[model samples]
Target: MEIKVNDIAVDISGRKVFSNVSFEMKKGEMVAITGPSGCGKTTLLNCLGMIKTVDYGKIMINGKNVTKYKDKEKTKFWHDYATFIYQDYGIIEDASVAYNVTLDKYKMNSDKVQKILKKVGLEGRNNELAIVLSGGEKQRIGIARAIFKNATVIYADEPTASLDVKNRELVIELLRQCAKKGAIVVLATHDERLVNECDRIIDMNQF
Candidate 1:
């Protein structure tokens, strides 16, 4: 899938957060959004993921203008085309790892779940409850879920924040592998090591 953002703008409480932000993202590519704190990287990610609408300009995905998608279409787009990995490592603390990874999707392939768990180095932990995991393990599960979804695009926010040096490299490698499998992987991060691995970098401060 291809994503194009043309002259998109967002404002918060009458203050402009970003203006004329434009870019093109596509499958098999990795792009990093980087900037100082409060530079609207998260806001831009929200817009791209269809979690929020642009105040002005256009957002197109696979030739469909997402700004004009109906509510039903928006829901379907999110369900089948994109998934997000949040900075807070969004996971259900009381749920089993398998439940957290598959959510409510009853038809999800169990082998695929195992494949993703193995990628995150959490191979035999499927039945374990999330609350017992350390912060790094929880974050790896978040990455696993993103990988398992196999969405057209993966929007990740500071995905390496909770990982150690070795796991950080491992997680980033997994995200790159997602792109290699034809998913556009876009991330908002401050880690120079991670950002350096991206195919391209968009500096939010330049907007």
Candidate 2:
């Protein structure tokens, strides 16, 4: 899979968030979006993830322009090929870890859930409530969901912003593993450690 952005730009309420940004990402690659706060890092990620629209230029996936994809098309793209991991963990706080990962999409069989959980170091915590887990564990659950979905593109926004040193390293390792498995991982982060682990960096301040 491939994602290409050519001279893309975005504006909100007459204020330009970013413009003339271009980059390409391939499968099995991890790219970092870096810059100071308010420099449009998240906005750029949103554009790439199809959560926001660009006012100029084009975004192409596999050589087809997706910048102007219809809502239905965008929804299908998200459902079939992409997933997001947010700083907040993005799982149902009151739900069981198994439920958060499968969400009834996959059968609630123990072996299936356990295998996925084990990948993120939550091996036997499937029955535990997400609300009871630590922040690092919660983030692992988020990564577990992405792995379960077998998503091709992963967008992580400040995934390690709230973690301590050990958990931050763990999250970084998991994201790297995803890329190694042929997924495109794009993350927005201020963590220099995370930045150094990426294959490439898109510094928004340079745009």
Candidate 3:
């Protein structure tokens, strides 16, 4: 799989968020988007994930220009091929760990949930409530869900911003593992360690 951004620009309420941004990503690659505050790092991530639109240029995925895709098409693309990991963890606070991973879309079978959970270092915590887990554990559940969906493109926005050093390292390693498994992992981060671990860096300051 591949994604190409060609001289893209975005505006919000008469303000220019960014301009002339271009990048390319291939499967099995991990890319970090870095810049100072107000440089549009998260805005760029939203554009790549199809959640926001660009005011100029185009976004291409696998040779198809997705920038022109309609709302329905964008929704379908997000459902079938993309997933996001947020700094907030994005878990259903009142739900069980297994429920959070599968989100009731996949069967809640013990073996299936256990397998993915184990991969994220949350072994056998399936029945536990997400409300009680640590921030790192909650983030792991977010990654576990991404793995379960087999998403081709993973967009992570400040995924480790809330974690302690140990958990931060763990989350970094887990994201690296996802890239190695052939997913295009793109993240917006200020953490130097996470940025160093990426295969490529898109320094937004250059735009």
Candidate 4:
């Protein structure tokens, strides 16, 4: 689950979003990407996660240069080795929690879904519609989904943007445990409280 970003650069519409970025982290490490608005914090995460390709330099995951991998190989790596916890909840508003966790019955049985729900503190809310859950609960569902997938790298973009103190703590703790479990957890956020607890903070504005 090691990640290495060397001289990474990105541009949009002839405007440079970020350039000459370099950093490295190993498994069990949690890194927070933080900076002012439009500083490319989220963009860097996308690049590292292979959602967005870089204009220059290389992104290495577990010693393999992702930029060099074929399209199909990259797609397979993204699906099987990485997971993203989107800020907008990334859940089906009309679907049940169990359905969102497993997507289809083949991924995980009802029993396994319940166990995952319990791990995220959603134990008995399996049958509840995603729309009925609060923002914090929805975030928990995203974490639960990530846990279910068991990806080696987890990317969370402002996962606690609109949550109260308690919920924010819960979200941060869940992400922390992901790192402790030997997954590389990277999150983009403006929350100082969350940033302070990370193993390292990569301030995009530094570039």
Candidate 1 lDDT over 61-157, as tens digits, reads: 9898999988899899878978888888899999888888889546334888887887788888888889998777887787677777777789999
Write model 3 residue lDDT over 28-125, tens digit each, in one string. Answer: 99999999988999999999988898999999999999999999999899899999998889999998899999888366675878899988898978
Measured on C-alpha atoms, candidate 3 has an lDDT of 0.92
lDDT (tens digit, per residue) of candidate 4 on 29-148 = 989999999999999989988889899999988888997778899789977888888999899999888888867756545677888898888888887889999999999998888788
Better of 1 and 3 by lDDT: 3
Tell me the TM-score of each prediction against the true structure: 0.94, 0.97, 0.97, 0.96
Top of the candidates by lDDT: 3
RMSD of 2: 1.1
Predicted candidate 1: what Cα RMSD to the true structure?
Answer: 1.5
Write one digit per residue (lDDT tens) for candidate 2, span 1-119: 99999999999999988889999999999999999999998999999998988999999999989987999999999999999999788989898889998788356555867898888
In candidate 4, where is summed lDDT lowest over 10 consecutive residues? Answer: 102-111
TM-score of 1: 0.94
What are the root-mean-square deviations of the candidates from the true structure over C-alphas? 1.5, 1.1, 1.1, 1.2
* Model with the higher lDDT, candidate 2 or 4: 2
Give the clashing residue pairs of candidate 2, or none.
Answer: none
